[model samples]
Target chain A: MRIVVLAGGIGGARFLRGLKAAAPDAEITVIGNTGDDIHLFGLKVCPDLDTVMYTLGGGIHEEQGWGRADESFTVKEELAAYGVGPEWFGLGDRDFATHIVRTQMIDAGYPLSAVTEALCARWRPGVRLIPMSDDRVETHVVIDTPEEGRKAVHFQEYWVRLHASVPAQAILPVGAETAKPAPGVLQAIGEADLVLFPPSNPVVSIGTILAVPGIRAAIAEAGVPVVGLSPIIGGAPVRGMADKVLAAVGVESTAAAVAAHYGSGLLDGWLVDTSDAAAVAEVEAAGIRCRAVPLLMTDVEAAAAMAREALELAEEVR
Target chain B: MRIVVLAGGIGGARFLRGLKAAAPDAEITVIGNTGDDIHLFGLKVCPDLDTVMYTLGGGIHEEQGWGRADESFTVKEELAAYGVGPEWFGLGDRDFATHIVRTQMIDAGYPLSAVTEALCARWRPGVRLIPMSDDRVETHVVIDTPEEGRKAVHFQEYWVRLHASVPAQAILPVGAETAKPAPGVLQAIGEADLVLFPPSNPVVSIGTILAVPGIRAAIAEAGVPVVGLSPIIGGAPVRGMADKVLAAVGVESTAAAVAAHYGSGLLDGWLVDTSDAAAVAEVEAAGIRCRAVPLLMTDVEAAAAMAREALELAEEVR
Candidate 1:
């Protein structure tokens, strides 16, 4: 199968790794969301692309879920000695080099998609990793908090800084309306035999990618089976604050509701945790092939199984 | 007194600390060369400015002469994992935060001068540390070598990368003529009662600052003495490679030659090492007051003595 996976950062990276293991023959092309790319300490950091690349490339920090292993910080101390600090986000000294190179290359007139490709060349993250767009598309969250009232915060600030405590009234992917899909993104969708949305965040994860101008339209027009493994396992996010974002988008924090939200127009197949098996009939009633295989993805083996099951469901729908 | 100082990195930072110790009441302004500033790991780093800031603010890595003590490198490891590196320049983990804040501030439409001022608010480096100019003016050295014939290299690549072994033919602070002095730089020179050239590289340090528009003229027309402490001690630089740069600027690396290179119109006074007393007479013949004193500033006490002696020479010239 020529698989095209739309991914966010950590969760999607981890899932892609399993998907690769599950179908070694299946050619995979990952279209990563670039809206979260931030310039910090003069380095251009694409959190999602890095997470996916590292997880697949075998350089990811096992414990941290982000950045690299065996990093140093001599440069960082020198920078701090210069009294340059925000001191909030955890950017390792070694990690800064990646962002630095990315920023430098971009500043030297290369688009971020090309930079990501160049960066991925060294990592050799088996499958092709493409950014959603070269243009800036930052994810901004609107929050009503006591201190700032109704204020917009960058996705990192909302997630890393605020720890997502404040009620997210709305999650807007800024510049998505204007962002063109990166080269080969639409082509991959058009060429795909099957597209699988991993058990990732519905709103900020898959939803953000769909928000990009031509992406959702391309997927809708692709004329292939699109399957998704639900992130809501047993009525809660398998990882991260996927439910928090769901609330922001006014989607009920449930497996069947989320699958139905993707609907028959986009999704031909929907997956659920075994615990949510009771909702399978209801989801199937919505004119989609519904499956109730375990979707927790506790380890790589389990994740591969999930991917395989999703693919199987895609076949069933086709 | 409205005192101005021309300085380089660590050695200069330490001397400035002692200068503050000796002349606490003097309205001291530092004209710091930005030649050593490099873009590493995506962060814009001003090494000399950092050195001055850290040394003055008590955050300096006293043993290493650069970076901060007790630093980390979590981010750097992450970066390397992404396979990004120059790897030679030390970038600490804790230090990355500083660069993040600095880059963020710069991206937010703040000029480097104002950003530096804001950073110094926290570091509180007592002497005003102003960049020679807001515009980039990197020093390049033309070197004649066995392998490359005559090739121009960045000051850092010459000094740090190549170790200054290659005989330098010419030194030029690129873009300096077109580069304007940073706001308040000329004003500081114009208002100075005494301008002291610290024991720093005459070509790359003090010379680069002088290369800026309106700086040298302002110092000359300041209506006060311009006194300089000799970097050349006992016919050699106290530290670093003043001789290599001297070769580039067509000046012999001697107290007398350095004195004559500055000339009478710009310099009112010059201090040399006691061992170079004979050269002091030659300096005096150039119509500039010359003092032979112990110019080896090993510690703050020794540097304070040098500062006191420089101020006294300014007094004598006045």
Candidate 2:
């Protein structure tokens, strides 16, 4: 079986781990979101891509579900000592090497897709990982502050620095309008038997990927079952500040609202947590097939079960 | 009082420390050799400038005479893990931060001189440290290897990787022919009350600085006394493999021969160690005043005495 998964950071990467376990023999292609990519200290950092890469490659800090395991902060501490900062973003020494290599290759004129391929040659993430777009596309969040009034900050500044406590006025994928899908993204979707949208932030993670010119249209027209797992459990995000960003895009923080936001034309099936079983009727009423399952990714086995349910739902939709 | 010093890596940094101790009230401007500056992992590693800066700033590894004290090699270890490396040059985590900040500033359109100044703002190295040239000028050494035949390699590869054991066929300052001295370099030499060449590599270090288009002329035309301390002690360098490069430039590794290589017109005074006292007459006979002093820099105090002797020799020439 050929599977194409659209992934964001932690939540998506964790889900991918379960998906790989659920179907070990299946050929998996991950279309990782690149809107969270930022250049800090002149090193290109793709948080979402790195998260997925580390998670699948067994190098991820298992508890944090993001950065590298056994990491050191000597580089970051030294950078801070030199008064070079955005000290909020914790890029560990081990993780910095990945960014350094990626940036070096990019500076040498290799496109991000080619760089990603080269990086994977070392990690051997067991899946074909490609970014949503090779072109720069930074996600920015507009927020109101008593001091600064209305201003757009990089998604990382909004999410990591501010902790998403402030109300987001708007979320913008700055360069997505002009960005093209990275090489093999559309072809991967077209060739896949099914497409899975892992429980990632709808507004900034999967939403930003869709914002790219060709990606959303290609996924919508792929002629294969398009399944999505809700990042929202009950009315709260399973992980991350997905609800805060969802509000910026005017979507309610509910499994049904998230499904309706993606819409029937684009989504073939949607999976809600067992607690939100009542919302399955509302989601199905909106013309997309819906299933309520125990979607809490408590462990690999539990997550694998969730993946199995999503695939079953995909079969039902087909 | 204004003092100008031409410097290289470890030896020059140690001498500068002594010079600072000897003439604390003097405003010292260091013309750091850029010939040893290299790009490793896409970050500019200015070994000579950093040694001077770190030595003066009290961040240098005292025993090693270069790099940062209490440094961690996490970044280097991680880079090696990624199979990306020269793996020979030891750049610690703290040192990586300096290069990262420098590379970022350079990429943002700041010249190396401005970037060096900005870095110094944090290091507070006391001296006004300027690279010999803002332009890229790498020292290359031609060597004959049984496997590669005759070829030119970067100075770092020749010294660090090969240990400079092979005889250097030629020493070329790759970009020095067209390179202009960095901002404030020529002016510092022109307006100096005194100029001193510390116990640094005569061929690759100070010689590369002189190779720049207008720097040698500025120093020669400066009316103030130009003095130098012999790097060669008795018949060998006190530290480093200066003999290999000295041979490349066809100068015997002797105190008098090095003084004669500078020529009496350029060097007003030359200070040789007391052990090389017999050669003082030969150096003086070439129309330059020569002093025989205890030149062994066993400690900062000893180095300070050497600096004081150079200053006295400058007064004698005046």
Candidate 3:
């Protein structure tokens, strides 16, 4: 079976890890979000791309769910000594090397898609990983700072630096309007028998990917099952600042509300956690097939179960 | 009295520290070389600037004479995992932060001089550290590379990676021909009561800074005594690959030979170590005041003594 997954960081990486285990024979293509990519220290840090790469390559700091395992910060301390520190977001020395190589390759005139391929050559994540676009589409949050008022902060500053405490007035994927899908992204969506949105931050994660010019249109036009796992579960986020991000999009933090947000026009199957079983009826009422499954992915086994449920839901929708 | 010193990395930073201790009330300006600057992980890494900052700020690794004390390498490890490493040079995570800020400031249209001023503010190195130029002038070494067969490689790659083992046919500061001194550099030199060149790598360090058009001319024109302590001690470099680099420039690695190379035109006075006292007559024979003193700076006290000797030599020459 041809399976296409649109993903963000941590949760998406974890989910993809399980999906790979559960369906080895299935052709998996991951369209990773690059909006979370930040130019830090003159290097491109694609959080989502790194998460997927590391998680699949078995180099991930499993506990942190981001960056390579056994990372060092010697470079960071040296920088601090030079008094050239932002010091908010952590960039490990090991992690810095990746950004360095990526930046060097990018500077050498290779498009990000080609750079991603070169990076993946070592990871060999067993799935074809494609960036949503080669274009520079940064996810920016418009926040009302005391001094700057409604200033646009880079997604990392909003997420990593501020810890997302400030009210996000609006979230924008800068350059998404002009972004073209990376080489195989649209083709994979069209060729896919099933499309899955893992339990990542809905509004910022998959939403950012969908915001790209051709991506959402391609997925919507694909005459196949489009399944989305509820990132919002049991009236709270399973992980990350999804609730805060959803508030920026004016969506309430609930599974049925989020499912209804994706809507029937784009979604064929919606999988909510069993705890939100009551909301399953409401999601189904939106004309999308809804299943209340055990969606708390505590481990790879649990994640596999969720993937299995999503794939099963896809078969049922078909 | 206001004093400014031209410097490179370790020796320069260490000497500046003593200069601060020797003349505590003097407003010291440091015209640091940016030729050793390398773009690693998307950040501009001014090794000499950082070395000066770290050494003076008490953050330098005492044993290593580079990077921070008690540094960690989580970032490097993480970067390697992501297959993003040349992995030769040690860049700690904290060190990465400095370059990030420098790069950001540079990108934001701040000349390296101003950016350096901002950085030195936090360091409070008691020295106004300014880059010789804001422009990019990379030092490259022409070597018989196995990959390219006698192509020029970055100085860092040649020095750190190849350990300067290969014979350098030529050492060129790329883009230096038209490069001018950064704002404040010439003014700082012109205004100085005295100028001192510490025992830094003569070729890449001081030579590279001098490669910037206005700086060497400014020093030559400055009415104040221009004194340089011998980097060559007893027919060998005090430290570094000076001997290897000197071969490229066709200069002999002797205290007298090096002093003669600088000549009476640029140097008003020169200080040689007690071990090279015999070479003093030869240096003095070249029409410049020369002194032989205990120049091995074992500690801050010793470094201060060296500074005093250089000052005395400058007074004699004047």
Instruction: Estimate the TM-score of every prediction.
Output: 0.91, 0.98, 0.89
Per-residue alpha-carbon lDDT of candidate 3 for residues A6-36, written as tens digits (9 for 90 to 100):
9999999999988998898999999999998
What lDDT would each prediction earn against the true structure? 0.83, 0.93, 0.86
Error of 1 at B13 (Å): 2.2
Candidate 2 C-alpha lDDT tens digits along B15-117:
9999999999999999999999999999999999999999999999999988999999988987897899989999998899999999999999999999999
Candidate 3: misplaced stretches above 4 Å? A40-42, A63-94, A140-171, A241-254, B82-85, B144-151
Model 3: per-residue Cα lDDT over B1-318, one tens digit each: 778788999888888877788878888888898898998766688999999988897778888888877776666665676666568988876666677778878878988888888877777787888898988999999998677788998999999999999899999999999888898888899899988889988889999988899888888998889999988898888878898888899899998887887778999889889999999899888987888988777788888888888777777877
Q: Which model is ahead, 1 or 2, in terms of DockQ?
A: 2
Ranking by TM-score: 2, 1, 3
Docking class of 3: acceptable
Where does candidate 2 stray beyond 4 Å? none
Put the candidates in DockQ order, highest first: 2, 3, 1
Could you report the DockQ of all the candidates, in the order they appear? 0.43, 0.81, 0.47
Give the range of the ten consecutive residues with the poorest summed lDDT in model 2 chain A: A214-223
lDDT of 1 by residue, B221-287 (tens): 8879889888888879888888888977789999989988988999999999999999988899889
* Model 1 misplacement above 4 A: A39-43, A67-88, A146-151, B70-88, B91-100, B145-149
Worst 10 residues of 3 chain A by lDDT: A76-85
Fnat of each prediction, in sequence: 0.63, 0.76, 0.82
A110-184, model 2: which lDDT tens digit per residue?
999999998888889999999999999999999999998999999999999999999999999999999999989
